[model samples]
Target chain A: METLIFDLDAKPLREVNQFLHGDASGLNGKAFVIENPNGAHSIAVGLKSDIHVTVKGHAGYYAAGMNQIAKVTIEGSAGSGVAENMMSGMVHVKGFASNAAGATANGGLLVIDGDAGLRTAIALKGADVVVGGSVGSFSAFMAQAGNFVILGDAGEGLGDSIYEAKIFVRGKVKSLGADCEEKTMNPEDRKILADLLAKSGHAGVNPDSFKQYGSARTLYHFHVDNAGAY
Target chain B: MSEQQPKIPQTKPRFSATFDESTMSEIRRAAATGIYDIRGAGAKRKVPHFDDLLFLGASVSRYPLEGYREKCATDVVLGARFAKKPIHLKTPVTIAGMSFGSLSANAKEALGRGASAAGTSTTTGDGGMTQEERGHSSILVYQYLPSRYGMNPDDLRKADAIEVVIGQGAKPGGGGMLLGQKITKRVAKMRCLPEGIDQRSSCRHPDWTGPDDLEIKIAEIREITDWEKPIYVKIGATRPYFDVALAVKAGADVVVLDGMQGGTAATQEVFIEHVGIPILAAIRPAVQALQDLGMHRKVQLIVSGGIRNGADVAKALALGADAVAIGTAALIALGDNDPHLEEEYQKLGTTAGAYDDWHEGRDPAGITTQDPELMKRLDPVKAGHRLANYLAVMTMEAQVIARACGKSHLHNLEPEDLVALTLEASAMAKVPLAGTNWIPGVTGF
Candidate 1:
C-alpha cells in the first residue's frame, strides 16, 4: 500500500488539503498518515475517494466532514461536527467527539469509542451511528431516518421531534423529549444491533441489554392539538 | 310614470378598518379550514420603494453624456474580500434564488440560461442545485439555508459561490413550507422527506446558535471549498445595520439584503406583509454597516425586493448597493401569471396577475408546478430568450438614466443625485426632498 505522510506543523492546512484535493480518485487503495495535527480544523474535508486516512493526533472541527466512500480513523478526540454530511463511508473516532458529530448526514457509519457531546446526530437523515460510551443531551434531534445505537447511558431530551429513525441504548436514559418514548426491541432490532455491534467492534456487548426508542408519530401531521409541541 | 324621482345623494363606499373585505375573508377561511392561508409571492400592499425617489437630470451644474456614443459601464465584481475567485458580472442585475421544487425544472433552467446569456449569475434556492441549473448556468451561487435540505458537499464544491441564507424577506423569522402536492418523488428523494407530505423547513440551523456560531460555520464552509469560492451572508431586511455588521464580522465576502417585497414559494400572508422593512429602507443601513466596518465596496452588497425597470436598479446602486437581484420580476419575465392564461387561472378561482396560490401547483403558466404536463408547457429555450430580452431592456433603460444623470458608470450615481418625492421617503432614503434643499431627518427643520 502506498502511504503518504503529512505533518501539519510543517505545512499549512490549506496546502495539505490541496494535495488531497489534487489526488481525488488517485488516492484509492492508498493510505495517508496525518501527523502532528495539533487540533487542526477541517482536515480531510470533502474527500471522495475510497482511501484510508489516519490522523495521528487530535482533530479540530469538522474532521473528515463530507466524506464519501473513504475510511477515516481519528486516533484522538475530535472537535465539533466530525463526519458531518457523510454520504457513504466509515469514520472511527477513538476518543470523545464534540457536539453535532453527524449533523444532517445522509448515509454513513460513524463509530465513536468514547462519549459524544450534545446534539450528536441532529437532523441525521440516513446514517447508522454507534457510540461505545454515553451521548449528551438532545441526541438525535429531528432525526428523520437512521439507526443510532449507544452502549452506555443517554443524556436528557433524547430524540426530540424524531421520525422513523430507531434508537437503541444499552444503559439507563435520563428522559425523553416530545413525542419520543421507549419501545420494546423485537427480534428484528436485536439482529440489527448485533450487526452494528459487530461492525463497530463492540460485539462483546450484549444486544439484549439495549432498549429501543422511537417517535410517537403524533406530530407527523399538522393538528391544533399538537400545536403546543411545535 | 314619468315623475322625476328624488335623486338621493350617492353614498360612496366607505371602507372599514376592522372589518375590511380581506380581513373578513381571512377570518372566514381560517374558521372553515382551521389553518392559516399559505401562499407564494410577497406583500400585496403598497409600500415605500424606489419609485418614491426620482433623479434630476444634468442640465447646467452637470453635463449629460451622449446617449448612444458615450460609454455607460455596468460591470460589477462580487466577493473581493477573501475569495480566491471573485464573481465578475457584466451587469449589476442578476436573477435571485428560486428553487427547482418551487419552480419547474424548465423555469430553473431558463433562469440559468438567461443569466448566463446576460453574463450574470443565477442562484439555487431552498432546494439544492439541480443538474439542469448547473449545466446551463455559467456562474451559479448555491444557497446554504437553515433547512439543510438537499445540501451536499459535492455541490458546494461545484458552485461558484455559497450564500448562507439567514432569513428571507417575505417571512423574516418564519420557516419555509412546501405543501404536499408539490413534493414529487424526485423532490422527496432530494429532501429526504416522505412523498406527498407537507415539508416544513426549520428556521434555525441545527449546528449553530448565534453570530459566534455563524462565524465557525462560515469558516467550516470556507474550509470545505478550500476558500476557492466566495461566501455570502443573506439576511432579511430587518435590523439591517446589525445584521450586515455581524455578517461581515462573521467573514462574509458578500452580503445579500432582501426586503419584505421579496417573494417566497410558500409563506403565511401575515408574515409576508408585516414582517420586514422595504428595500429602499434596507440598502442605506446595510451600506452604512459595511462602511462602518471599513469594507463597503470590499464586500459587495446585493439588494433585492421590488426591483423593476432601469430606474429601480439605478436607485439601488446609487444608494450603495453593488448589485440588485430579481425574483418576482424574473418569474414574471418567465411567463408566470400571464394574462393569456386567463381561462386556466380563472378555473383555479384566481385571475391572471393576481394569482398568488403557487403552493397549489396549478399554475397555468407552467412556471411553478411539478405537474408533468404543465411543466412541459414551458419551453426553457423560449422562456430563456424572453428573460434575456427583458434583462437587455432593463440594462439599456438604466444606461439611458445614467447618461441623463451625467454618470458614466452605474456606481457613480450617488445619493446626492437623487431626491425623494415624499417626507417618509426622504427620511427613509436620507435624501433631499424634490423641490427643497432639505432632507426630512437631516437638513429639514
Candidate 2:
C-alpha cells in the first residue's frame, strides 16, 4: 500500500480532515501519516474508511473522535477525549491520555499504554477499552455496554451507575460508586479479558490476576431504597 | 315541621386555600407510592403567557396594509452565520424535538411529513435520529444529546442541521428517564441497553463540559460534517441571558431556547412545574444577549414552549425572536388528548385533556405508545394533513396581525407594536402596560 504523508505545519488540520473524509471507496486500505501535530485538536476526526492513520506527536482534544472503520495510532501523549464515540476500529495511544478517553464509544478497541485521566470510558456503549496504566476518578461513570480492562490501579468511583459493561482491574480499586460491585470472573469473562489483553499488546499479563466489576442490578428500576444512591 | 324550622345560622362549607384538592390528591398519591410522581407534557399550572400580551394595530399614526392585496412575508433563514447552506423556511414556525421512544414511529413520520409540507423543520430528540423521520422530513435537525445513543458520524453528516442539547425546559438539571414499560426491544437495542430496563440519560455530555470545552466539541462536529450543516446549541430557560450568550460564545450558528412550558416524555412532576422560567419571560433576555453580542439576526434564536397560535408566534417575534418552535401543540394537532378517545382514556383512569401519563405506554391516542395495536390507530397521512392545516392557519393568522401592525414581514414586528395586560406580563415581556406607558421592570417607559 502506498503511504500518504501530510505535514500539519504546511497544511491546515481542516484540509487533512477534508481529504480523509473524501470518497471512502478510493481512500480505503491506505496508510497515512500526520507530522508536526503540535497538539492540534480534532486531528483525524470522523474518519470513515478502512485506512490506517499514524500521528507522530502529541494530539489535542477529541483526536480521532467519532471515528469509524479506521485505525489510528498516536505515538505521543494525547489530550482529552481521544477516540470519543468511536464506532469501530482501533485507537492506540503510546503515551498518557487526558480526560474522557474513549467516551461514549459504541464499538471500538481503545488501547492506552500509559495512565488515563478522569472519566475514561464514561457512558461507554459497547466499546472495549484496555489501559496499561492507572486511570483517574469516575472512570466509566455510566458505562452501558462494553468491556473495560485496566492493568493498573483505578481511581475513585470506578464504574459508577454502570450497566451491563464488564470491568476487569488487575490492581486495587480505591472505591466503587453506587450500583457498582465486584463480581466473580467466569470463563466467558476470562476469555474476553484475555482477548482484549492480547489485542492491546498485553499478552504476557495473566487474566486470572484481574478482578471483575459490574452493575449490582439494584438501580435498574427506580425504588425508594435506591434514592440515597441516586 | 315547626320544631325543625327553629332558627339556625347557615354557613358555607369552605376548603383550605393552601391545601387544594389537587394538592391533597398528589400528597396522597405520593404517600401511596414511594417514588415521586412522573408524568409527561408541560406545566399544567397557569403562568403569564402570550395571552397576557396584545398587539397594537395601526390606526392614526401608522398605516395598515390591505389584507388580501399586500403580502406579509413569514419566511425565515436559520444558521446563516457559519453554515455553507442555511435552512430556508416558508413559515417561522417549526416543530420541536420529540424522541422516537417518547412518540411512536407513526407520530414521528407524521411530524416530519407535516413540517415538510409546511416548508419548515422538525428536530430529533434524545433517543437519536430515526429513519422514518429522516426519510420523511425535508429539513431535519438531528439532536446531539448527552446520552449519545445511536449517535454516529454518518447520521451527523446526513443531517441538515445539528443541535447540541445542553438541557431541556421541563427538567433542566435533571436527565431523561424512559421507564421500563416503554423500553421495547428496538428502543433498547438503539440505546445499547438491555431490554425492559429503565434507561436514564445523563444530564451532561460525556466527552466535554463547560463553554470552553464546548467550543472545541462544536469544532469537532463541524470538522466531521465539513461545516456544511448548521450547528445549533439548545438550552432550557433557566438563565436565558447567560445561557444564550454562552451558547453564542461557544460558536453556535443558532441558539434554541426552550422555556418552562416545554413538554417532556417523562420527568418528575415537581421538576417540570418548578424548574425553568416561562417563555414569555425568557425571549427578551435571550434576544438582549444576542443584541449585546451584536449577533441578533446573524445568529438566529428559536424560542419554544406553549407557542399555541399565530398570535404567540407574532408575540415571540415582536420580542426579538427570529422564529418559534412548537412541541405540545404539534402533538395536539396529531390528535393527542382528543375527545374522541375519551372512553379509552377513562379506562386508563384519566379523562381526555387531563391525560399526561405518557410514561405508562398506555396512550389512548396512540401517539405516545409502542404497542402495535395502539400505534396502528394513528394514520400518518391524516395526522400530517392535520398538522399542515394547523401550520397554515397559524402562518395566516400571524400575517394578518403583521399586516394590521403595518409591517410587511413577520420579522419586522417590534416590541413597540405590543402591550401587556398585566404588570407581571409587562415586566416579563418588557412591554408597556395597556392604557399606560409603564413597563414595571424598566426604569422609564
Candidate 3:
C-alpha cells in the first residue's frame, strides 16, 4: 500500500481532505499520516473510501465525522464529537476523548483507550463502541441500536432512554436513567461482547465480569405512568 | 302562547366568552386522557395575518402598467451569497419541508413533480430525504435535522441545497413526534427504529449547540460537500431579529423563517398554537435584521406559514422577504381535506375542511397515510398537475398586483405600496394604517 504524508503546519486541512475525497478506486487501500494536527476542527471528516488515517497530535471537534469505509486513529486526546455520525468505519482514540464521542453514528466501530467525556455514544444507531477506560455521565442516552462495552467505571445516568442497544459495563454504575435497567447476559450477549472486546484490542478482558443493561421497554409508548420519567 | 310565555326574560342561552364550546370540548377531552392532545397542521387560532394588509394600487401620483401587456417578473435567486450554484426559480413561491413518514410517498412524489413543473424548489423534512422526492424534484433542499435519521454524507453531496433545521414553527422548543401508527415497516426501516415504535426526534442537534458552535457545524458541512451546495439555516419565528442575525453571522447562505402558522406532522396542540409568533409579525423583523447587517438580497430570506395566495406572496415580498414557502397550502393543492371526502371525514368524526388528525394515519384524502390502500387513491401525476395549476394561478395573481402597484417585478414591491387594515397588523408589519399616516411603532411617524 502506498503511504501519503501531509504536514498540517505547511498545508491547509482543506487540501488534505479534498485529496482524501478523491476517486475511491485510487484512494482505497492507502495509508495517510497527518502530522502536527494542533487540535484543528473537522480534520479527515466525511471520508468515504477504505483508507487508513493516523493523526499524530491532538485533534479538535468532529474529527472523522460522518466517516464511511475508513479507519481513523488519533494518537493524542481528541476534542468533542470525534467520529460523530460515522457509518461503517472504525475510529480509535489512543488518548482521552471529549464530549459526545461517536454521537448518532448509524454504523461504525469506535474504540477509546482513555476516558471519554459526557454523552458518549448518544443516539447511537447500530454502532459498536468500546471504551477501555471510564466514561462520563449520560453515556448512551437515547441510543437506538448497537452495542457498547465499557471496561471501566461509568458515570451517572448511564444509558438514559436507551432503546435496543446493549450496554456492557465491567465497573460500577453510579446511576441509570429512565427506561434503562440491568439485564441478564445470555450466551449471545457474551459472544457479541467478546467479539467487540477482541475487535477493539481487549481480547484478554473477561466478558463474564461485565453486566449487561438495556431498555426496560416501559417508555416505548406514551403512558401516564411514565410522565414523571420524561 | 296564551300569556306570551308569561313575559319571561331569557338570556338567549349565551355561551361564555372565556370558555367557548371548543375550549370546553378540549378541556373535557384532556380530562378523559392523561396525555396532551397531539395533532397535525398549523395553529388553528386566528391571528393578524395577510388578510389584515392591503395593497395600494397606483392612481394619481404613481403610474400603473397594463396588467396583460407588461411583463411582471416573478423570478427569484436563492443562496447567491456563497454557493457556487444558486437556486433559480420562475416563481417566488416554493414548497416547505414535510417528512415522508408524515406524508405518503405518492404525496412526496406529487410535491416534487408539482414544484418542478412550477419551476420552484421543494424541501425534505425531519425523516430525511426519500428517493421519491429526490428523483422527481428538479431542485431539492435536503434537511439536516436534529435526529440525524437517514442522514449521510452521500445524500448531503447529492442535494442542491442543505437546510440546517434549528427549530420548527409549530413546536419550536419541542421535538417531532411520529406516533406508532405512522411508523410502518418502510418508515421504521428508513429511520432505523423498531417497527411501530413512537419515534421522537431530538430538539437539538447531537453534535453541536449555540450560534458559535453552529458556525463550526456549518463549516464542517461545507467541507463535506466541498462548498458546492448552498447551506441554509432555518429557524422558527420566535425572536426573528436576533435569530436571523445570528444565522447570518453563522455563515448561512439563506435564512428560512417559519412562523406560528407553519404546519407540523404531529405535535402537542398547545405547543403548536401557543409557541411561536405569527408570520405576519415575523417578516419585518427578520428583514430588518438582514438590512441591519447589510445582507439584504445578498443573503436571501424565505418566510413561510399560512401563505395561501399570490396576495400573500406579494405582501411578504413588500415586507422585504425575498421569497415565500407554503406547506399546508401545498397539501391542499394536492387535495387534502377535500369536500369530496366529506363522507369519509364524517366517519372519522370530523368535517372535510376541519379534519386535522393527521397523526392518526387515517387521512381520507390519502395524502398523510402510510396505508397502501389509502396511498393508492392518490395519483401523483394528477395531484402534481393540480399543484402546478395552483402555483401558476398564484404567480399570475402576484404579477397582477405588482403591475397594479407600478412595479415591473415582484421583488420591486416595497412597504410603501402596502397598508394595514388594523392596528395590530400595522405594528407587526411596520406599515401605516389605511386612511392615515400612522405606523403604530415607528416614532418618526
Candidate 4:
C-alpha cells in the first residue's frame, strides 16, 4: 500500500486532519506519518475509517476528538482533553497526555503510552481506555460504564464520583471516589487489559501486576450517608 | 495613589443618541412604532435588569459613617479558612483575569501597577504569568485555566494567589478563542503556538475533573507552591449551588462566580450574548448552597460580570458577594471608554459606547486595541495612575454604601438593606420590591 507522510511543521490541524480522514479527498486506506505535531488541536478529529496514523510530536487539547474507526497514535506530550467523546476504533498516545483524556467517551479504545494528567477518563460512558503509564488525580470521575486501565501510579483522589465503570491500575492508588473501591482483579480484567495492550502493540505489559479499581456501588444515586463526601 | 477623584475631561455635551443621516432614519423608523426595537429572542422575556435595584440610605436605626472621612476599610483577608495564612487585600475591588497574549504587555503592566497603587490585586488570564505583571503588581493572582498555556513551575511559585478557572460568565461552557490577529510572535511563543494563528482554548482541564480530582489537583498546586499562596476556584454562574458546594468541599479557599456579562478575550457573538445565568440570579443560590454546607463566609465569594461602578459592588455584596471583580470596567479606567478617542473608534466600525471588538485588537486607546500605533497612544505609567484612582473611587463608593447600611466592612452589606425597583431583580437578587411587597412574576419560583 502506498503511504503518505505529512510534515507537521506549522500545518494547520484542520488542513492536516482534513487530508487524513475527510473522505476520498483524504488519505483513504493509506498509511500516513505526521512528524512534529506540536500544539496542534483536534488532529484527526471526527475520523471514521480504516487507515493508520502516527503522530511524531506533542499534541494539544482534544486530539483525535470524536474519532471513530481509524487508528491514531500520538508520540509526544499531549495537552488536556485528548480524544474526548470518541465513539469507536483506537487512539493511542506514546507520551503523557494531559487531564480529561477520553472524557465522556462512548466507545472505542484509547491507549496512552505515558503518564496522563489529571481527570483521566472523566464522565466516560462507554469507552475502553488503557493507559500504559500512571494517571494524575481524579481518574474515571463520574464514569458511567467503561474500562479504564492505568499501568502506573494513580494520583490522589482516583475514581472520585465514579459510576459503574471498571478501572485497573498497576501501581499505588492515592484515593477512591464515593462509589469506587478496590476490586478483585479477576480473569476478565486481566484478559481485557492484556488484550488491549496487544491491540495497541505494547505486549511487554504484565497483566498480573495490575490490580482492579472500580465503583463501590454505594454512592451511585446520592444517599444520606454518602452526602458527607459530596 | 491617594483616595481622591481626579477631574475628568467633560468635553462632550450631555446629549443622547446622535446618529448620522442614514442611521438616524433607521432609528426614527424603528421608534415610529409604539414598541421598542426587537432584538434577540432572549430580550423579550422578563430577565433581570441591573437598573431595577436601588440602595437604601442610612436610617435613624443604622449609623452612616463619614463617606469621605472615616476609614471604612475596603481591605479583606481571603483564604482564611483553608490556607495557613490568608491574603490581606488592600481594596475589596480586584482586577479580573485578562491574559497577556490577549492584552498587550504594557496593558498588563498597567493593571498590575494600578492595582498595586490602589491596594488591590491584579489577576493573570488564560496565559501564564508574565514578569511584567508580577513586577508591577503588589499582589498578583495567577489563573490556571484548562488550556495550561505557558504554565510552568517558576511562575506558579511566584504568584500570590492561584485561581483555578473552570469557566467564565460570558460563555459558561464556551472555550477561549484568541483570534488570529492577536497572536503576535511574542504571544505565539508564550502560548506555544504559531504566530498569527487563531487559537481555541480547551474546555476541560488536562488532568482531572469533579471535586474528588479537584481536591488532589488543589493539593498538588499547594505542594508546588509550598502552601503559601491562597487558592481560588472560579466557575461560570451556572449550577452555582452544586459548583460552589463542590468547590468548597474540594478545598477551594475562595469561590469566584463569573456572570453572563463577563468579558471574554474572544468568543462567538452568539455564545457571548447567550449562555450562562446573570450574576444577580447566581449569588443567592450559591450562598444558600454554602450555608447549607455550613461553609458560608468560610469560603469567600467573589462575584464578577456586569459590574460597572461602586454601586454595583455594594449591591453585589448586599446580595451575598464577599468581593467584586471587574474586567471591562478596569479596562475603561485604563482608557477603554474614553469618548476622547471617538474619531479613531469610527474607523473600527464601532463607537465609544458600542465597541465590543476586543478580539480585533485594533483598540484606539491602546488597552483593548492591539495595533502598534494605537498601543503607542497609551502611557503605561499614566494609565496605571488612572486605574489606581478608579479603584480607590470604587472602594470608597462601596464604603459609603456600607456605612449607610449601618455596616463597617463591605461584606457586612446584607440582603435586607436592599430593595428592588423591578420584579425580575427582586427574584434574582432575592430582595423585596419597593412600593408594594409583591415580586411581579415569580409567585411560584
lDDT of 1 by residue, A1-230 (tens): 98999988888888777677666667788899999998988888877888889999899888888888889999999989899888889899999999989888888899999999999988888889999999999999888888999999899999998877899999988999888988888998889889999999997989988999998988776676787886
- For model 2, the stretches where C-alpha displacement exceeds 4 angstroms are B1-5
lDDT tens readout by residue for model 1, B1-445: 6989898998998989879998999999999888778889998888998999999889889999999799999999998788999999999999888888899999999999999999999999887989999999999999998778899888999999999999989988888988878999999888887787777787887777789778978887887787889999989999999999999999999999999999999998889999999998999889999999999899999999998898999999989999999999999999998999999988998899999999878888888999999999899999999888888888888889999999899988899889999888988898888989888768846
List TM-score per model, in order: 0.95, 0.99, 0.98, 0.63
Q: Which portions of model 1 show Cα errors greater than 4 Å?
A: A181-188, B1-13
B162-245 in candidate 4: lDDT tens per residue?
A: 999999987788678677677788786676554665565768775566787678667656644546678999999889999999
How would you encode candidate 2's per-residue C-alpha lDDT over B165-247 as one tens digit per residue?
99978888888999998889998888899888888999999889899999999999999898898999999999999999999
Give the better candidate number (1 or 3) by DockQ: 3
Clashing pairs in 3: none
Lowest summed lDDT across 10 adjacent residues in model 2 chain B is found at B1-10
Computed on alpha carbons, the lDDT of every model, listed in order, comes to 0.89, 0.94, 0.93, 0.77
Winner by TM-score: 2
RMSD of 1: 2.4
CAPRI category for model 1: medium
DockQ of each: 0.55, 0.88, 0.74, 0.05
User: Interface Cα RMSD for all candidates?
Assistant: 1.6, 0.7, 0.8, 17.8
Question: Which segments of model 3 are wrong by more than 4 Å?
Answer: B1-6
Per-residue lDDT of candidate 4, residues A67-181 (tens digit): 6677888888776667776778788888888878987676799988888888889767678998878898877876766789887888888887565678888789987766688
Using TM-score as the yardstick, the better of models 1 and 3 is: 3
Q: Put down candidate 3 lDDT per residue, B149-219, tens digits, no spaces.
A: 87878889889999999997898888898989999999988888888988889998887879999998998
What ordering of candidates by TM-score runs from best to worst? 2, 3, 1, 4
Q: How many collisions per candidate?
A: 0, 1, 0, 13
Which of 2 and 3 is ahead in TM-score? 2
